[model samples]
Target: MGIFDALNTSVGGLQAQSFALQNISGNIANASTVGYKGIGTSFEDLVPAAAATNRQNSAGVTAHSQATITTKGTVSRSSVSTNMAIVGDGFFNVQKPVGITDNIPVFNGVTNYTRRGDFQLNANGNLVNGAGYYLLGVTVDPKTGNPTGNVPKVLQFQNNFIPAQATTSINYAANLPTKPATVASTTATAGGLKAYGGLDPSDFSAGFNPLVIGTPAPPFTDATTSGSTVNNKQATQISGATLLSGAASTDSIITNFAAGDTITVNGTPITFVASGAVGNQLNVTDSVSTMLAKIDSITGATTASSVTNGIITLHTGTASNLTISSSNATAFAALGFASPTTQARGGGGTVGAGVVIGNDIKVFTNESISGGAVTAYDATGTPVNLQLRWAKVDSSSLGSPHVDTWNLFYQANSSATGTQTAWINAGTNFRFSASGALTSPSGSSISLPGVTVDGQSLGTQTFNFGSGGLTQYASTGGTATINNIFQNGYAAGQLQSIAVNNSGLVVGTFSNGQNLNLAAVSLSHFNGTNYLKALDGGAYAATDESGVAIAGATGTINGSALEGSNTDIADEFTKLIVTQQAYSANTKVITTANSMVQDLLNVLR
Candidate 1:
């Protein structure tokens, strides 16, 4: 072996220690850098060919650099929305642009991978990381929200307006009271009966009086509060001592009668006989009152005959179907009686008491019922107010027609004919089951067609109240509660901000309270991470050793945050101390080797 062999080996040691120190300095410098992978220097020793003597001096040491790319770093938090981190083995696909301006990244074809994720938006609205690398992702269709292609591109957030959406469907959920409020009280008379109470089951909205028919006659009772009382036939009457007293013993005789004379009261005949008859036709004198007693003797006639001062009324026998007619209409009129018309009780036929039929809709005021309102949008994105009122119909008592029917009325300010606080017929009625759940208006969906809003048309909007949408259980606190109300319509919205999710989804939020997916972040994985070439700013490039990068092989993508540097500062410092000492020791060895070589040179001289 040459005497200077030791010197050469020490020189190699010095160079190796210097290389390790450089790695330590780099690690320490980047301790706080985001997504930085620390470098560790590995040392290898070379030996000269073995001699037959079995001992040979060592050759110089060789140092190589390896990136701790596979090692995971502690996850720390960041405020930037575009920031992300990797939890396992993978790298973010990024493009390092050739240049940048106003925070905008200039894209270069060169693709790189990184553990760094401190990304921010640039002037061109491109997402760029702290390393000046543009974030790469798949472009997404604004209309479909799906990936446009497998080819990745630099992510850019553009300042654009979101187009308006027309209302297609509306979802509605609310609790309609099973029992509605009552209408106002009103009074009227029918069939000579005084009537007053509710128009519906709870309150009366309109008043009706049978006095409307004409002067109520005798035997016609007062119209009761609800037209539930009996109504009888009637006629105007007059009775006193002079008209009733007759020629014989207080018997009536107002006019002399002939044998052929006849008066038919309610289809029954009163035939007058000649003067020979005794006690016939109630003294046969034809007095106004005494002769009337003879007429009451007919069937189905309730005669209140006192032979004096008793108004002829309430002729009831088997039945009181009273109608007075004769061959000559003048004959009944001549008896001090107007033409007797067949009588019909109120609410029976043409009596004309207002009552709806066959679930017909009717308008009612909120003063007599509860109401609600909702804000709806139109084609032009204008808001319209729709007001609704609930009016109870039918009865509160239980049976067939158990009285749970209701009428819902609505009015909008955008109505073509103009709006009124007074409810307008909505063309439908809501009926409820006895258990208080809605039964009619199947599906509980209502449609408002041809509605106008802010002078624009808003087509038909179907409001799905769903099954069991309404109820009438008694409760003290009521809020007109709306479980949910949403429409598929919106005005144009300005882009507000962007966000990323762990699934690598890029979302854009707008001012109109809508969020949309804009793009998708892609990741790359290598079969041999250590074989990847290290690039500037904690990045890597593909090499033959790294193999083909598999796209979409990602660890968890943390958003609005950054991944911390893997380098431990204290550990780097320790390495620095060891490297510094080793370097010094290597230098000392070189000097000692030189001295020994010089000694050999002197001995040879």
Candidate 2:
């Protein structure tokens, strides 16, 4: 009975060793498999019951497969963009198709988890691994890039045109030079940069006003007749009292007016008569005071009409531009004016007209610096180049109340000609303090309403410059230094391709060069991974021993890469040698037990 017991125990030891060998063989076979978790054998010893605890005999040994689920595998780079790899302890949620229905894979509604991430887009645009399991993920809102729901499902992407989105706001940032090097700058060279066709500071109303910054006043003409002194009289005594008739000895006469000479004030004529003239008519013998009154009455001048020391001065008085011409050049010369003179009133500037025509292009170029340019999209997804320029209006160097002020402009038409609207003012005076910080614009954004570029209207949009995005620092180049400028809109484009990103999100690259988030790859974890039911192709199923799959996992996914098998060939081979030796040793024990049984049989005979 003891020999029989030993024989049975040796047979059990052989069976256990065979089980261990089987596990070692499987590990060696799957050494090159992707995302394979190696299995090891755990031996358990069986003890036979005896009368006394100290007299217990060894029954046999049993082997159980041990799961190496927590062990990580080596990750290597792959050429496929959609391929993903897990670097930690989580598995990708996937599903296997039960059958094909109408050429589509029908899911069995059972969720499975796997680490084999050799996924590629199938015919139906679903992500499937080599083992035919479809990948599952949560949908994401393309605009917000946020997950739509917490539940993970099979993801399918279609190659359809996305609707066009109009631009609402632009994320912009840039710096402005304190001393802008404009064409009208005083430091400009004369050889190639002459002021002839360049913008002059006088083109701007605020820049030309003497009261605002002093000096550089408008051209005022006060003509004197060659010499101010007349008829050998004292210099201060000569004025409107000077006579036009050269024959009068007591009257102050410089240049004599003839009887047929005519002077025109704003196209209204005043004729010289031999004698007894009235109503837009001046007598040859009339005094300078009489002629002045007739001229003022014809021109409707309320102010700036005077004669000082034989000099005639006239002003348009803010009502209209003054145009004075004369049929008789000599008579106009005597009147202390050029033959044809036109002078615009104060407060008139082309830059304030909100539209810069082709005739004013040279002036605009000379006054403004290139701000930047960006291609923006409209509601129809029409792309337009939004070109901008900055014109420095006021400077802090001009003292208090005159900080560094600038006006923004955009090109309305590229080919605009004379009197055609080419540029439009943004209508806000951006002011900066002496410390180069924005002072007037209290917020981070500004409105550009009805922004039309080159005949295309982009409607209204906001330029969002985050806090401290704009600065007015000193630069040696004296140009606007653009730090950053971008828009939130894009043209309608077809879905070109999709790829998994490092953030575990599936991004779709459109034909219009925009990459948008489409879905978030979901990872699942289990408390008892080793207790999971092993499925085909490195997949696992939930069981009573293994807890339910949790949604959030600490593992990270890598794009364009894959995880290798965790099985080591060298280690498996070493275990194989040990298993062979144990199996042979068990067989020897069985043979010795058989020999002992033979000897006992011989004694009984």
RMSD to truth, every model = 10.0, 6.3
Query: lDDT per residue, candidate 1, 406-447, as tens digits?
Result: 555455333232122123444455666667677777766877
Which candidate achieves the best lDDT against the true structure?
2
- Scored by lDDT, model 2 comes in at 0.78
TM-score list, all predictions: 0.64, 0.81
Off by over 4 Å in 1: 51-59, 87-89, 99-106, 141-144, 175-374, 386-455, 460-475, 501-503, 511-513
Off by over 4 Å in 2: 186-243, 248-342, 346-359, 415-420
Please, what are the lDDT tens digits per residue for candidate 2 over residues 1-605?
Answer: 99999999899999999988888888888888888899989999988789999898778788899999889889999999999999887999999999999999999889999999999998898999988889999989887778899999999987846777778877778898887778677644452221211233445443222111232343432321222223323245344456666654555455666787787777788888999897889888777767767766765666536566655666564445667777777655655667787766654432234556677687678777899998888889999899988877677665667567777778889999866678877777788988999987899898988988888889898988889998988988988888898998898888889999898999999998888999999999999989988898999999989999998789999999999999988888888888899899999999999999999999989
Task: Return the top candidate by TM-score.
Answer: 2
TM-score of 1: 0.64
